[model samples]
Target: MSEPTMDHHRWGMVLARPRGLLTAEPFWSETADGIEEGLQHTQILFFLHQVPGLQEELEVYRRWSAQGFVHGVILVNPLVNDPRPALVDQLGLASLHAGVETPAPGSASIVSDNVESTRRVLERLHALGHTRIARVSGPSHLAHTHIRNTVSRQIAQELGISVRIVAGEYSEESGRRATAELLGLPAAGRPTAIIYDNDTMALAGLATASALGMQVPDDVSLVAWDDSASCQLASPPITAIAQDVHAFGRTIAQCVRRIESGESSFEVPEPAHHWLRRASVAEVSPPR
Candidate 1:
């Protein structure tokens, strides 16, 4: 099939963070080629996520749609949840579908199952005989927190377990603060296990536990998601759920291709999380 191309005056895009540490340069160069050949000069709008004024960028995109100059907006970071509600009350759900002046049929997004993955990590904790468990979650602004929080609550209810949730912003500092908070609880209130959303937070938790003279799987067990290189290099290797990020990027690119081709939005197949068996968890011992 021939590659689809947009007319000079036809298409526009509203990109977010297309040039970040996470972005692959070659892929972006290809995307730039498509936009240049397929769009009117005024039709393309690129907004970096770290830009000072996001609202202003979105406003211009909204205006393009309002004036019927653009077909729709394509967000680069498909993982991030809707920020319109918090950013602009005028641009709520209703306005989104109608104001864009395009049918919502082809709108697509992609994200990992934060809830199910966290549940798996929690189940591993339960298997280790950990009754008291705590969670260090990433920022609440994104939809990832919503999924993780819901799944955690469900698992805890079914297993008759309790989880203490500490909010962190996916940074070492936030991780440290959360770990300190977890350690401050009374002996009886302290969790026998702690889980983090990402690998970085997990490493911080381990460091904090060591500072408090707690040994992994001896005093408390540890678990986290996204098995990064740091987890493998730790003194006692960490157990984690690993996602194929390269495959994830390719899948997202495919999804974008489908949308660009005017195809219906389709759900991407669920990516399996690989469980890395390691020495972080030990069988729970009964009270001495």
Candidate 2:
């Protein structure tokens, strides 16, 4: 088969992760490395803007699409009722969306199975004898957060576990504040285990737990989504849902290459997410 020709030599990606993720988090850094590796001849440009509102993202896409500044673009952390897909279709732009289940008519997607992974984590906690659990989730606007929160609550109900959810901005500060709030509840009402949406927040939760004089896996357990080296570096290490973020990036790059080559029927496989057991969780003891 003949190789597809790319209209533009440069591709672009806009990321909406916490600041310093590319440098601080191995997952983001490794994914960026993978994207670079997957590029054959075309140059990829990245716009690192943390939490740029949906409207701002739309403008960036519009300006770039209109100017032909980039041959293609990748969008990360899509919102509920996202308009990027429709905008991409209208602008005749070549694009890919990461972690979005429903792509616009003209774009392709590389997504994680949020619902399944969340269920697995919750099930493991329940099996460990934890009855009261809490989650520190990312902003409610992102589709993945909503999916995870929904699945978490649903499975907790099914398992007859008590669940509490707190919202965060995917920031360490928010994680710290949320952790403090959860820990402040009456001893009988506090959760025995806490789940964070990301490793950064998980680390913050660990710190907060320490400041509050709580022992992990004894007084409370910690788990995080998006596993990274930092998870293993903690005092007790952390349990996490590990996803192949590097592979996720490479898949997005591949999809962009295919779209650039004029391929219309492309499907990026959903990346797998699984539990990574560590020292963070322990079996609950029978109350006296």
Candidate 3:
């Protein structure tokens, strides 16, 4: 006769955005199971795969949490020291409360260690006889850009190789523009090899080289960081670092579980960077 004692174990959740980078269905289904098992009045899960960026969506999660729509939120891709810190801080200050609130009082992030990954990738290029290499980095404001550029520069300097850098957004168009800029440089000033932050940029760079009547490996070798599907079908089939995106998604879901159990910090093994050797690189010959 007692109103069924509210399931104290129930804790609702709100997920951040599109989870998979390489594939989706597998993680979506696994995450759905987590949601069902956690729905016992102690948990209620609501995912936001359609939301824009981290800060904006965190605010939405706070609103719904305050209205009892969800007890907690499972967010992703919250790059720290972000350009939009003010927005994130403001939302955090507004959401602090008795029980339902931003769990950590700030954005919690789970991301691949991009800097170390890039460093290893650069080392791979160096081993392949790429001495004079250039970098096509992502936008300056993003944390991934900062990490990749820092590692690239540090490694290039240590190896005594000349490195050139061109900045662009993480889009194919940005990659095209950056590539054109590199090609515009005099042949004497240009590096013999180019590395891009993502597969999108690498693929675009290949097109730009073709437009300029240049042959990859013979004219300029190319390497990309993220291993996307398009990277494999390019004329020469780009060499790239293939990440386990399915593992990334599953890790985020697991982080949420730990946070709910009063464990504020969870550590994941840094992703190891591997080079997929293809036809994009060529051996350099001494000048006559």
Number of the top candidate by lDDT?
A: 2
Q: What is the C-alpha lDDT of each candidate?
A: 0.60, 0.79, 0.61
Ranking by TM-score: 2, 3, 1
If the candidates were sorted by their lDDT against the true structure, best first, what order would they fall in? Answer: 2, 3, 1
Determine the backbone clash count of candidate 3: 10
Worst 10 residues of 2 by lDDT: 43-52
TM-score of each: 0.69, 0.90, 0.73
The TM-score of candidate 1 is 0.69
- Per-residue lDDT of 128 in model 2: 85
Q: Stretches of candidate 3 above 4 Å error?
A: 1-46, 49-58, 78-80, 83-111
Candidate 3: pairs in clash: 9-42, 10-41, 10-42, 10-43, 11-42, 11-43, 11-44, 12-44, 13-44, 13-46
lDDT per residue for candidate 3 within 170-208, as digits (tens), equals 567778998898888887777788998777778889999
How many residue pairs clash in each candidate at the backbone level?
0, 0, 10
Error of 2 at 256 (Å): 1.4
Off by over 4 Å in 1: 1-106
For residues 110-217, what per-residue lDDT tens digits would candidate 2 score against the true structure?
766787788888888888888899999989989999998898889988998888999987788888999999999998889999999988889999999999999997
